[model samples]
Structure formats: C-alpha cells, structure tokens
Target: MSCATLFPRLLGDVGGTNARFGWQAAPGQALQNIRVLACADHAGIDLAIEHYLHSEGLDRPRAACLGIACPVTGDSVRMTNHHWAFSVQALQQQLGLQALRVINDFTALALSLPDLPADSKIPVGGPLRGAEQAPVALIGPGTGLGVSGLLPSQGQWLPMAGEGGHVTLAARTALEFETLQVLQHRFGHVSAERVLSGQGLEDLHAALRCVRGDTAPQQPLDAAGITRLALQQGESSCLQTLDMFAVFLGRVAGDLALTLGARGGLFIGGGIVPRLLGWFEHSGFRREFEDKGRYGVYLAEVPVWVIHTEHSPALWGAARALDQLH
Candidate 1:
C-alpha cells in the first residue's frame, strides 16, 4: 500500500511512564481521539493499543507508527525503563497492520522540531537567534534523559538517534564530586540519567542528605512531592536538589551543543523541565550551560527553546514518519 493513502493510521509516542496515542483518518486530517494511557495500566504495547482503539471505537488501522522510549535498533525492542518487550514484526502481525514503523521517542520529537510553531516553544535564554544551518540538539529529562539531534542537509532535516543519556556524567564542584561519591555507593555506575531524571530528583534529594550527614530519616519524596516541598515550604535540601538538577542539565546540554556544534538551536523537551516553569528560566541551567570557559561565547550564540504542549507532539512526528516511509 502507498504510505500517503493509508487511512486510520495509529500514531503513538510511548514513554516510560505514559503512552500517548492518536488516530488519523485519511491524509492531512488533524489527529482525532488523542489519548494518554498510563503504561502501568496495560500489560504491554499491544494491550495498550488495543485499549486505545477499543475506547475510541475505531476499527483496525492499516498502518501504525510509534516513537518508543527505547532503542529500536532491530525488530526486537526492549524498553529501557519498563518491562515491556516485543518483536516489531510480531506486533505488526498481531495487529494485522500492513506496515508498522518504530523509532526512538526523542528521534521522533526531533523530526517535529522544524514544524513546531513559534509559540509552542518557550525560549529559556541565550541570544535570540542561532546559526540557521547548524545541527539542532535536543535533550530532555523525564523517566529517563533523552538525547538526539537534527542535522541539516540539502535544505532538509535528518534526525540522529542514540542513547546519549547513558553517557558518563561529569561533576563540576567539590560538592558535586562528593555527591557523586555518595551516589556511587548507592548506584555503582552513575550515568547522566541517574541524576537527571524523575527518579533522579528523588535519589539526589536522599543523596544530598547523606552528604550533609543528616541522620534524621525523613520520608522519601517523589519528584512532584520534592518540588512541592521546595516550592511550598522552602525546604533547604529540596531547594538545593532542584538547583543542582538545573545546573547538571545545563552542563549536559552544553556538552551536547558543543559536540554537535548545534548552533541551529538546542531544544529541551520531556515532562520535567516545562513544569519547572519560572524557576527553570532563572535557574543555574543556563549559567552552567555557558560555563565552558573559553567556549562560553560560542554557546551564548546557540538559542535554547523549551517545548511545551498539553498533548504529545510526538504523535504528529509519528504521522510525519509514516508519510516519509515508502
């Protein structure tokens, strides 16, 4: 079947915590029946898709596309932060789909960058413009950190996907180094995601207590709860945790920009940063991002935009991928 003519296509963006799905009927039609499903509510991807389709009262789709929060190297896909594992070919057969395409969730997000409207993106800080032709970098923190980039070629954008979030973390201060030591004891290899994700916020809060010799066994807090404590009660430890989080994010994003020379722009996506809102715009994230000494000036020219939307824009990205598929 020709890709463009495929109707009732299923578009999805599967994250560690949530799976967002949309239905597109015919070409150039706005996605309908957009829904967000908790990953834990369903047993696996197939069940989740079935539940979505059932609830929407939609028929079987001819083609389906997904942006999953894991490596889609071959037919076998094992989620990095969840237990759901399946073969892509098997899934296509089970759904009786004529075609099914899957790619890294962040890669799909990258594909949607150029098409993103100006208002949908909130500029955090930096010069107002970026080099139009340079690579555009993207990194975001959610259940795990996601990293990807878009390389401009022949007036077209090509998305690059990799597990850049698993890269070794770098520490900038004596306190940060000490914190890493504490984290090392708790988790053997502290990757960037260890200190930059949702769980990372909670773990960092506890690790900070250990570093400060706070022997008082306080109740554990999740990311939202921790942020509540910081925002509502001005808890000192919680405050510091968020502070360090922004700084670490900046440094990591800076490293990405430097590596890709992403002067076109650097986009921040995912569930965490946008919630930070005002605090994030004023946080050390930007400072640490440009703290690369001699290279600070270069980074200063790289524009940074934070993606915010009530629904998953990745669904549109999946739709675009389907259109591109031959």
Candidate 2:
C-alpha cells in the first residue's frame, strides 16, 4: 500500500503541555492546518483530537499516528507531566480509525533526524564533520527532560528511547559542585532533570540565593518571569541561574555524546533553549561540551545543532511512521 492510499492521515505530537495536530494530505506533501492545542483545555486525548478536527473543518482521518510524551509500552498511555490517559485501541475505535500508531515523542524526534532541514537548526559550536553514519544524540528540556539517540544500522535508522535525563548530574566547577550539594540536600537524588527543566530554573535560582547567603523572596519568579528578568531586565540572580543552566546542559550533553559515541552530532530540541538562543550561544555551553580532558579534541570534532523549526519534528516523524505502515 502506498502512502497516497492513506490520504488525509492525522499526525500529532502530544507533549506534556501542548498537543500539536496536522493533516498530511498525501505522501511527501507538506502538513496542512497545523494547530497547537493546550492539553489543559481538553479532558482527554479524544476530546482534543475532536476539537482540532472540528476547528479545522477536516474530515475523519482513516489512520492516525501520535508521538506522545510518554512511554508507549502497550495500548494504554499515561502522560508523565499531564493528566490525559487513554488506551490506544479504545481511542481508535472511538474515532472510527482503521489504524492508530502511538510512539514515544523522543523516539519520533530521533526518527526525524535525517529529515531535519539545515535552515531549521542553528549550529552551536564545532565544525560540521559530516559523520552522518555515526550515531546521533538527542536531548531536550521542557516540562521535563527527554533523552534519545539515533543509531544507523544496515540501511535504516533506529531510535533508542531511554531515561538518560535521570542520570546523576556531574559537577566540575566549585559553583556547580556547591549547587549540586544544595540540590542533593533538598531533593536527595538530584537527577539532571532537577536542574535543567522549567521548574529547574526556578529551583536553581533559589539554590543560588542559598549559596550566596542572600535573602530569597517569599515567592520567587517562575521560569518565564526569571527568563524575562535575565534576558530583558538583566537581573543578577536570574542571569546567574540561566548561566548555570546552560553550563549544566552542556556537561550533560557531553556525557551523553561520550556514552553513545555520538560522533555524528548532538541535537538540542525543546521549548526552552530556542528562546534564549542569544545568551546560550555566548554562554559556556560549548566550553563545557568539550571539557572532557583527554577526549576534548574528539568532542571538538563533533557538531552540535539546536533545532529551531516552527513545526514539530515529532509530528513529521509520526507522518513518516504512518507511511512506513503502508
């Protein structure tokens, strides 16, 4: 069966905070009527889809594929950061679709690596060595941290989905070590996600205050407020927090690259990094990325790109996966 036979397939990238939907009219055709719906606005996945279709004046699709922000080990899926939960088979039946494929969002992102347009990404540091055949690492921080990788096997790209963000965060500098100590005292385990996410930014600000022995506000600013103060107003605490966040992100990215031997490249996605591109480009991200003592030269040879595309790669990956089914 050709993808043309599956005209008007539904492609969705369902994240913890928002759900993006698009209509793939045919194979190789551009996605149409793409819209993002807040997950909180809907009661369940079924309602969100229904509202999207109705708003777009689209007909019921024959088949659908959703790249969801959770492990799709079976038919049932419970989002890690959201309240939406449903069974795949039951939802398919409810929507009267012939086929429904659900996959991990990070895995979908890994699958889209080959298709990522050059203009859609901004190179962070290092030369583009063109190690296309080697493995590629994917890590992003949003409502939570997501980690995955793409391995080239035979003539196909295989996506690896794992909880790499939950690994113990390594600290090199005195400030980083102090911050880690503070985090460990408060949260015990102190996973990388604890200091690299939206809430993580807020937590980092509070930790910095504790380290400096400064008085903290009764209620510190949220992630957005902190970002605004740092980028627009030049608040010292917010700026320091963002700087540490970038450095920590780079350290974690380097570890992941070394662990996976991701010489092909490292790609950064998610909602946060792209917003602070200016500061991130000038921060210690590249330095930390190549801070591996003996392996510094090797990491320097590897390229790092931050995805800046308006359309979600996960949505594109879902469409590609649906085409593969045919």
Using lDDT as the measure, the top candidate is 1
Per-residue lDDT over 1-326 for candidate 1, one digit per residue giving the tens place of the 0 to 100 score: 56777888999999999999999998878999999999999999999999999999999999999999998999999999998899999999999999999999999999999888888899988877678788999999999999999999998888998999999888979999999999998899999999999999999989888899999867888999988888788888999999999999999999999999999989999999998887889999999999999999999989899999888888888888888888
Determine which window of 10 residues in candidate 2 has minimal summed lDDT: 1-10
What residue pairs clash in candidate 1, if any at all? Answer: none
lDDT by residue (1-326, candidate 2, tens digit) is 55446777998989889999999876678899999999999999999999999999999998899988887899889998899999999999999888888888888888888989889879999886548689999999987888999999997888887878789898887988898899899999999989888988889888888999887455778999999999999988899999999999999999999999999999998889999988888898999999999999999988999999988988888877776675
**Candidate 1's C-alpha lDDT?**
0.92
Candidate 2 matches the true fold with a TM-score of: 0.95
Assess every candidate by TM-score: 0.98, 0.95
**What do the candidate models score in CA lDDT, each in turn?**
0.92, 0.89
Off by over 4 Å in 1: none
Give me the runs in candidate 2 sitting further than 4 Å from their true place: 1-4, 216-218
lDDT of 1 at 123: 92
